[model samples]
Target chain A: MNNTDIKRITPKNITDKEFFYGHKACAGCGGSIAVRLALKVLGERTFAVLPAGCMSAVGFIFPQMAFVNNAIISTFPGSASMASGVSVGARALGLKDYKTVVFAGDGGTADIGLQALSGAIDRNEDIIYVCYDNEAYMNTGIQKSGLTPFGTKTTTTPAGKNIHGAQSFKKNMFEIMAAHEIAYAATASIGYPQDYIDKINRAKHTKGTSFIHVYASCPTGWGIPTETTVQIAKEAVDSGLFYLAEYQNRKFKLNKNPKSFFSAKDYLLKQARFKHLTDDDINIIEQQRDEKWEYMREHWK
Target chain B: MSNKKLFISGDEAVAIGTKLSRPNVISAYPITPQTVTVERLSEMVESGELKAEYMHVESEHSAMSAAMGVSAVGARAFTATSSQGLLYMAEGLHYASGGRYPIVMMNANRSLALPWSIYGDQRDSLSLLDSGWIQVYVEDAQEALDMIIQAYKIAENKDVLTPFMINLDGFVLTHTYELVEIPEQEKVDEFLPPFQTPNKMSFEEPKNLAFSTTPADNLEYKYQQNRAMFNSINVINDVDKEFGDKFERYYGGMVQEYRCDDAEVVMLTLGSITGTVRMIVDKLRDEGKKVGLLKIRYMRPFPEKEIIKLAKNVKAIGVVEKDISFGYEGTVFTNVNSALSKIDNAPLSLNFLCGMGGRDVSKSDIYNMFISLFNAVKGEKQKRVQFINMGVETDE
Candidate 1:
């Protein structure tokens, strides 16, 4: 769906009612923004399971919760399993209308929490597991995560003499979720609020297991100014670094593909995580980005 | 009340007890020794014999996590695991008890890996003594079956909302077949009412559960949890007594004492090994040796008063354990001594660590341990801790 189409379908009466607010997140934390927007779509009658991540640490600040709906802070790698239990318990209790959602970070989702995630989806658990990907382990102070891009400077992957930064490409989480053959798997960005809301709404209404991988920016971790968080996310998508798409019923559909993709070097230069990249590193990154873009264009219907 | 007997393993007995209790959710991952319990539960769920949601999780961690989820929604939930699986679910054990979910889990006691043995041992559950779970070690298939039913009531008691671990020896109890009297479902339904809780996850109130707490308020929550654990001792006795009155059976409330009134020597044990200890006590009694046996049923609410009372009358006591606390004596021995230390004149005690990795704790081994206890009572010099039948040569 295009931006205009998304806006046209968006609910005008959608409450700017912030279900989560006044927490300890950074000034322009993309993860909390995505959670706020997603909870707005999910509405009430929703129980959220937050793992040991930014959301759990900030949203649940001991005796002072920011969430309006029922929420729990489960163990680091148990969000999916906890959500599965909540969904099954709700059904067993004859409260099947209640929605169980898992709000986890990239470190919790792609690395420590992947096994439980796969198990829940494979069981076709009736829950929505949303991975707010900030590229690295931002809550733990910019440590390297599986979703960290190649040549990005995280705490573990510092730009030293011999090694530039991270040496691996970002893990394809959407592809992994799609492989589970879940009822719904989609990618959304905080920059595209309307598109993100639409995907969350669709996921909420859909049955079976639904996974939404949201590209959330971390200004503190990326060494960028807090005011440009949304701008950086938009540039990441427009520059072909991050793709927005949905996979359902064994069919792949591009959600919002840019008419003319910007240069990957420009996107990398916008954040300090990739500021140390050399000319050769940028060329390799740009080539890999274009190849991935071409592959998505050819494959995504 | 028809007391129909069924020839089955302790694993099957646990399944029967769970079926009778009518749990709302059963989540478990298959592990050795404990695998049969979940297998039977799954079959019951599939065959429509048990109406419940069975979640086949990826690991023991998820199993316990799911069980907590179910319990948080005012449903009785159950799960089973052993050895490494128990260690894997160790993190969730604290959560279940701390969150006051009242989940019931059966842990087929097995040895921890390293040398890698799936044999019967108490190391798994004994090592997790401080995880805030009310642990009950059963002696035979019958107690295993009955305690599984009693565990739910004890855990779900409003005064004691703690999770319980019903431990049965790996091969001895889990694999051995015996004629166990499976209670009728209606009797169990009358015994355990439907779980009712105001602390569950709800849409009407929308309260945060299992939330993060600062140090300022964290200790108070733990104090409440500890208070609940202390309260469970009374609840356990009441439930066991009520269960006995209904089912015409009693496992002697927490610590089962046999012939200990005027005995000079008493042997303390847990799990399946208690049977062999009791047999040794009978043989010793026949030989005119004033020997007795104290089978510990519940370990968490340590039965400190009962232990002190039992030991105060005896001249000497020996604690037989399948686990060692490494550097310290056996965990049970340590707890018993801790309880005894409070008394002015406690009995002379010794620790016998046997059956590690299921090395047989034969009848001869029990006789030898008794001999050591008798000798210690006579003021003979002896090692405070002994590894029974370890086959290792010690330069004494």
Candidate 2:
């Protein structure tokens, strides 16, 4: 998209809202940026339930919180369940103006917390569940997570002579959520702030359970320069390794498609975590990426 | 309005109590023995007899997490579980108590799995004594209903913001039917006010809850929780007294003493087993055996002061419990001994682990326990800890 098109799509009131400022997030932290943009769309009457993750550790540091609104820090796998309670309780107490939202990580969504997340969505609870996927468990020092893509090096998935990095592909949480037949499911990236904010706003307006999977880049874990965090996330989508899409009413639509898609090798070569990949490994990754894009194209069309 | 008497099981009585309490949210997962309680609650919600959000959670962990969320929003919340289900919720239990959410939950005390027994036992609730919750054991259906109603008042007290667990023995009190008095809704409403607290998540004056604390601040928060737990003793007594005065039914404060006045041998018990012991005590009293009964009502506050005062004059005290603390003695026996240790001239105590895995503690078993306590009071050396009715040969 051109600069004018981007400007036209972006919300005019985007400003330096300090609701989530003074957090302990690392430099060029895309997770914190996603949280900031999400709160902007949710506005002031939003109540949040944060599970054990980078957001829970950084945003809520006892007696001093970065959130202007109330936020309940939950157990590692309890964000969705707690949000269900908060939403129901708020309605029971006759508070209709406030919104209940859950901010969790990939591990807290697809792995340890999947059951609770599934329970909440199946009940069609009135809450917005947002997962900022940094691929690995960044808060616990970059361990492998189910959302971690194949052939990515994490502490647990160290590239060794006998074994490659994470052997399994990312657990397609967006598809899983869509399979639940929820009212809304979408994927966004920090590189596309306008798309991220717009999807979040759309989720906030939707009545039932709404889930947004955000591809938030972690420069510290991904072994990239702090300044290149957004660029890396953009490259991920542009390379077709990650796709921006939405699901509603049993229909899927692609939100952004690069005019000339880059190769998965180009995206992997930029990050040190994938530096151990050989030509054969890169070939497999490229094939998998192409298959995913083809799948999305078929579904979107 | 006059109270109505109905024949119901302990689980049904608990459902009635919860209905009268008017919780705004009840999240539960079905477990054996506790299933009927949740089932009855679901029926109430479905039939519009109780207006609440009943969340059929996927697991006990989610049930507790949801209860905490409901309570954090300044609305009354409830849940029920048993055995492994309670163990599954252990992590969230600490979170609920640490966050100081006044959630009231019911625990149908069942044996923990290993050998895999589903019958009644106190091991589940007894093992969680240090999880920072107010634990109460009821002897019958009537007390189960009444105490559950009072639990909300004690838990939601501004001075004592802690979760409460109303424990009734699985298959014993939970499945056994008895006559229980259902109090009028207006009276219950008058006794227990609508939940209102500043510790909730409010959009008007937003504040952080359950925030992460560093080592420097964590200790103070725990100390504050301890203070609240200690304060709950007074709140429990006050609420019990208020409930008694209003409903014309009273359960003795902390430890209910029956005919301990000039008795030389007093037996301490908890849960439904207390009822059988009460019968034995009455029969022994008729025979002029000088026996009495002390039913422990609240386990968390420990009732150390009351137990010490009661045991000081007795020659021997016997603690009969269904739970053993593994390498140690029965948990109730341990607490009673710890309390007695505070007194310089404390009475000699014996631990009688009975009715484990729902093994029936017949009248003869209660008679045998009393005989041992009587013999100990007469300076006859008896075993300090005896596993009553284990159906195995032992050196007597």
Candidate 3:
């Protein structure tokens, strides 16, 4: 659905209710922003699941829980299965209306949780799985994750002369989910709050498993200024380093395809994790971005 | 439907019992011996005989995780697994128990893999005894079915909101056919009303559940979990008694004593091996031997009290189990010793490490075990732990 045709809920129209707040999230935490906005769109009647990751760590500190909706912390690798259970449990219990949402991190989703998430999608579980990707295992002090971009340094994937940074590219999570032929799958960035909210709204209304991978920047882990988390995340999308896309009904749709991209070199230089990269490394990263966008431009609608 | 006798395998009995429990969610992956239970449940779901969400999860880890989800929403959940699959869900096992999710699982007792054998053994469940689950072993297909029904009532009790696992010997009980009197659905409904608990995420309260706690507050949660699991011993007795009153079958709470009245040498057994041990005991009794049998039903809220009471009268107790603690003794032997140690004058206990990796505990083997025990009572000096039916020479 296009913007004009769809009756969208903006900040002005969004509920004045605050469901997620007063947590230990970093000042410029994009993951927290994503969770707050998604919870707003899904509302208080939602059964939210936070796996053993960043959001769960910050939100569920025993007596000081931040979620206003009924929520539970799932095992690190069991977000999908647990979310599926919550949805079916409520349905089987004859609860007519409710949403089941999962807020997982990069490692929790792309690495450990992939199998369970795929299972849920295969079963066509009526739940929304929002993966707030911070590129690394931010909760555990910035260890490299499956979604960590190449040339980025983390505790696990350290930068040095022998190996500059992570030796692998970010996994194509959005497409991997699309390959399941899920009811809906989307890639979003915290930089673009409106787009992220729109995708969550689609997930809220979906009758089957819906996946939304929101690129949330980790200020503490990435060594970026707290206030620049959203800007940096948005710039990566604008620079074609990360693209916004959706998969529905066996079709891939590109949400944002800049005719003239922002500089990937500049985007990388802003983050401390990528500061160690040389000009040659930047060239390789930019080349990878160009190749990915070329294919997305040629293939996706 | 009225209660009717039907000859079926232990796995089929489990499926029937699960159906009667009326769980809202069942998530499991296919594993040997345990596969039949899920297959039958699937058929039931497809045929509209059971109305439940049968989630075909990709792994046992997810299977248990989903069951926790089912429980966290205050819905009844069921799952089945065997051997490696049980180990795969080990982390979730502790999580389910600690979360106070009253999920019921039927585990086919199979050996853990190294050389890899999909046969009857108590090692798998024994290995995970400390995972905070209330574990029970059945002697036959009938008890397997009956326990599957009672497991729900005991687990869902407000004072005992912990996960329960009903174990059946792989290939032996899981595959063996027996004439089982399936409880009528209406009667089972009366026995197990509905799973109700305060330990769930609710819309009315909007509570966050299963969160991390500071070390200051952590032990109290565990202390409470400990209380619930131990308190379940009474619930087990109460539930089994009520089941007997309604269904005409009673599993003697945590431990069942057969002919242990004034006996000097009593043999303890678990799962399907108990029947063979009972037969051996009966044969010795026919020959004028003062021998008896003790069957361990629940292993977690262990039959410590009953064991201590029984040991007070017995001269010696022999434990026949299929598990080893490696360089120590049988796991059950260790647990039984711990209980008997609590008393001033504990009886002489021997551990018989028999039937590993699904090997049959033949009646001959069980008879030999009793002979060994009877000999032990007669001041025969042998090792504390002996491997029965050993084919190879041991240095000892």
Candidate 3 residue spans exceeding 4 A from truth: A1-6, B1-3
- For residue A259, model 1's alpha carbon misses the true position, in angstroms, by 3.2
Candidate 2 lDDT by residue in tens digits, A173-283: 999999999989999999888888878877877889999999999999999999999998888888888889998889888987666687778789889899999998888
B279-359, model 1: which lDDT tens digit per residue? 898999999999999998889988899998887788998999999988878999999999999998889999999999999
* Candidate 1 segments exceeding 4 Å error: A1-11
Candidate 3 CAPRI grade: high
Models ranked on DockQ: 3, 2, 1
Provide interface RMSD per model, one decimal. Answer: 1.0, 0.8, 0.7
Q: After superposition, how far is residue A228 of candidate 2 from its true place, in Å?
A: 0.8
DockQ measured for candidate 3: 0.87
CAPRI quality of model 2: high
lDDT ranking from best candidate downward: 3, 2, 1
Candidate 2 residues lying further than 4 Å off, grouped into runs, are: A1-9, B394-396
Candidate 3 per-residue lDDT, tens place, A1-301, comes to 3445456878889988899998988888999999999998999899999899989999988789999999999988999999999998888999978999999999999999999999999999999999999999999889988999998899988999899999899999999999999999999999999999898888888789999999998889988899898899999899998889988888889998889989888888888899999999999998998899889989997
Best by TM-score: 3
Q: What number of clashing residue pairs does each candidate have, in the order they appear?
A: 0, 0, 1
- lDDT (Cα) of model 2: 0.91
